[model samples]
Target chain A: MTVFTLINISLLAILVATALTVSRLRALYEAAMLSALFSLVTACLFVLLDAVDVAFTEAAVGVGISTVLLLGGLALTRSREAVTPRRRRLPGAAVAILAGGTLVYASQDLPAFGSADSPVQRHPLTDTYLHQSQEDIGIPNTVTSVLASYRGLDTLGELLVVFTAGVAVLALLGPLAHPVDARRRDDLDLVDYRVLRVISAMLMPFILLFALYVLFHGDFGPGGGFQAGVIFAAGFVLYGLVFGLDKAQQVVPRVVLWALIPFGLLLYLGVGVVNMLLGGSFLDYDTLSSDPAAGQHLGILLVESAIGITVAAVMTTVFFSFANRRATR
Target chain B: MIGTHYVYWLLFALMMIGLYVVISHGNLLKKLIGLTLFQVGVFLFFISIGKVDGGSAPIVSDDVETYSHPLPQVLILTAIVVGVATLAVGLGLAVRIFETYGTVEEEDVLERDTTP
Candidate 1:
């Protein structure tokens, strides 16, 4: 048997087991944990598929950060449901038939399992990045080049989405309405998490460093602003969990955070304006420098920085809003 | 030896199981887990479709070199991040629901929904 055949069998077994466990498991917490395990396995599959950057993200966000957040949310609430399933098996059967038919229809046109030549490989966009990117952008990693350079504008919008969500959380949640005033308490106290506080404190610097490395390293890899920003904010969140939200606020500063929203937004707009002044289209970095390649790199770097700032600030602000509600109440 | 079609069958089976749990189960966390399972099953399906039976790993090692479908993997990575973000937001909503309802059970939470 081939290696893929063997791998497929194991994967099939795992997916089945995880599904059954999720269905049979009664407790919400157990189910969430099981789901996280599934995500981790799926991430491993991604790595095996040569998607290492994605694998790192899936493991970090899906298995680690998101799971912890879900559990923490669960802790504030009760565990498990009181009701059992009463739905019949036929609706599912009918749905399955429909979905199956749809899948078959779609698969008919799809290239057989990994036909060496497919639209994905031959697509103009990927072709440009794969062949033209090295000379045009001076980046080793085509994915990063595409994400930060070719699609810089899209990344800017994504940053805005994150920033807006952060603001919406704080504005609607009402707990962090006046973060500055409430950040003055005995912020040194770690509450029930003194040990955790110490660990997170030790880890925070490294986490931030990793974020920077990812940001600067994107020229050759999948590390970029959006991912780096999320990771950086996550590190701060770990700190908040350990040292308490109030303490986190003091260090981050309500002024700095609230200001960062506009700052990140303006920084992005500024890049666009710079492009306009330099005689390129809005956000076109090639105009900023005499050499288009240098301009592209600088543009990507600046746009990436903007993305990182917004993601970090937004995620931290949103989490603070969640934890601060009861504390302030 | 099993044929390649059987591999597709297994993928279909896994997908069905996950979808069933998600739609049939009433437990909130169970639903989330099922949703995640359902999503991952789909990813597996796509990744499986991207695999070449005799092709080597996509990595460009000195000893052996081959090309494989790398796009799907990257797309799946994005999906995974989107999945986690959705889960975080969903859990946040669940927390809010619990705070107002004092329970995580679907039926109980629903009944108490109007109470708040």
Candidate 2:
């Protein structure tokens, strides 16, 4: 067997084992950790498949922030899952089996794995994005070009969805505030372990710095705004977990997060508006500057920065809401 | 020759396992885990489909002659972010459900609903 096949087999085995373990485990904490493991393995798989950007985001958001957020949610609720009765399980299993079977059957018609001559590779859109984009966008990263410029509207819609989710959480959980419970203050301080405190304090600055790197590096590499934003929030999340929630809040206060949430979305929308005023289509960056390539560069940078800001604020907002609920409860 | 499709088959199995967990488990948290598994499995499947026989990473470099399609990678990249956002919202709702009903089990919450 080739080395690639060996790596794939091992990673798949690990993924399967982790999934099964997570499914059977009743303890919420263990399950959450296992899910994080699942994400890490998936990220590795993405790397093997030559999708470095997806791998980076998956590692940062899926493995890192999402796991932390799950734990935060668990803090407000029970850690152990109630036992599901055996008889009630069949229907769901049957449906899943049926769906899996159908998908596999459909896959029979697909071209073999990793064929360079596959229909997807021969598609005109792929050819255009691969070759024309370099000259048009003047960015090394074709994915960013396609994402931020070619499919600008879809990205706008995605940003709005994330914004809406943030708004919904704020509505549901109310504002971020300190824990009302005197007992909770003591509970929060438990994370004030001297070792964790000192280590995290040392790490938070570097993490934030790395986040900035990811945000700006999108033009040339796998790093981008979404991954950077999550990393930024994750730094604060680590701070919150280590110190007390109140201390973390003092650092990033609820008011600032709230304001920043909409500010980022508006910034993105503003870019489009400017384009319209400049005699171009909405989000068409060509009119933004004298040189079309330069315009594309500037538009992508602004839009990506906007994405970073909104995503960071929203994720931090959701975490605070969850933590706030737990404390107040 | 057909055995080469093992990767896809394995991914399908994982997806089914995730689906089964979401469907069969009564606990809300377990259900969320299942949903996540299902989603990740789909991600793997997409990435697998995009792989070329000997293509390098899609990043533009003069050294590489063949590259996998960048479009699917971009699509999946956005989907990953959306997936996490959706998971956050779902978890928030789950927390609220626990707060109101004092349990994260679906059956327990259903039994407590006596508005009729």
Candidate of highest TM-score: 2
State the DockQ of every prediction: 0.37, 0.74
Candidate 2 error regions (>4 Å): A176-184, A327-329
Best by lDDT: 2
Model 2 per-residue lDDT tens digits across residues A1-329: 88888898899999988898998899989999989989989999999999999999999888778898788778878889877787877898789889989988998888888888788988898878878898899898888888889988888888898899888877766543223421235565647489988888898889999999999999899877788888998898888878988899899988899999999999999999999999999999989899999999999999999999999999998887777664325
Candidate 1 lDDT by residue in tens digits, B1-116 = 13535555666666776777666665566567667777777877766665554554343334644444445554554455556555555655666666666655676666765676
TM-score of chain A of each: 0.86, 0.95
lDDT of 1 by residue, A144-234 (tens): 6666667667656655655655665666543544545343334334676767767777888999899899889877666776678778878
Candidate 2 deviates by what RMSD?
A: 2.0
- Where does model 1 sit among the CAPRI classes? acceptable
Q: What is the model-wide C-alpha lDDT for candidate 1? A: 0.66
